[model samples]
Target: MSSSRRVRPLTALALAASAVGTLLVTAPTASAGDYAGACIRSVGSRTSPNGWLIPARNFQAGSSGTCVREIQFDIAATIGLDPADAPGFIDGAFGPKTDRYVREFQSRSHLEPDGIVGPRTWEALISRTTD
Candidate 1:
């Protein structure tokens, strides 16, 4: 198995048009992250020509940053749950509400119901699967 995702850039217009059939994004067949509940990854921030890149840090109730924000966005997209309902979610700050949602997502996706976003949790979110 390879931890490589594929991506085809769509024009901004195309992306703005609709996401139904305009994007070509795929997940890695192998794990791209081994975060392991640690928040060590706090630097590398750039758009990937490849599809999604998993974060190397674990986001918990106190994490806050662009990476956390990205994961927050994906949480709603993957679980099809509205972020507004979770209060402080989707705002880059992993508060108690985000923790709750993360745990709920973990349980729903058959991952450990630990309120931490580790590699597996990142996979579930960035893989864009409800799981």
Candidate 2:
């Protein structure tokens, strides 16, 4: 096999090993625009084509910003929360409502259901969200 082919698997492994937080000074992704309390993460490309915006640290009930918005969108989508009915579902605020939904998503995915969107939750959410 060519060197590039050998590198691809290693690149994927490194990407998976990447932690939840790494500061990226560039602009945030499209789906998740800059927001108050937003965390600039380098979990993925800044271009943003409908993926989770994981933060530089664990996000819980008090976090808000681009990362939270991505989480809200993914979790709500996977858990079947209608945006019209639950406005907070994707409000970009990690409030009580979002935390509740996170736990639900986690439980369904067989995670710890801690309501904390760390590396495990991020991976699970990203894999589960096909849309």
Which lDDT tens digits does candidate 2 get at residues 13-100?
Answer: 7776663234343536645233312445433323123455444566899987677877887776678774564754677689888888
What residue pairs clash in candidate 2, if any at all?
Answer: 21-56
Local error of candidate 2 at 82, Å? Answer: 6.0
Top of the candidates by lDDT: 2
**What's the CA error at residue 68 for candidate 2, in Å?**
0.2
lDDT, candidate 1, at 52: 46
Off by over 4 Å in 2: 1-54, 82-85
Global fold similarity of model 2 (TM-score): 0.57
The CA lDDT at 55 in model 1 is 58
lDDT for every model? 0.64, 0.68
Specify the poorest-scoring 10-residue window by lDDT in model 1. 30-39
Candidate 2 C-alpha error for residue 101, in Å: 0.4
TM-score of 1: 0.55
Candidate 1 C-alpha lDDT tens digits along 86-105: 55556678887778878988
Q: TM-scores for all candidates?
A: 0.55, 0.57
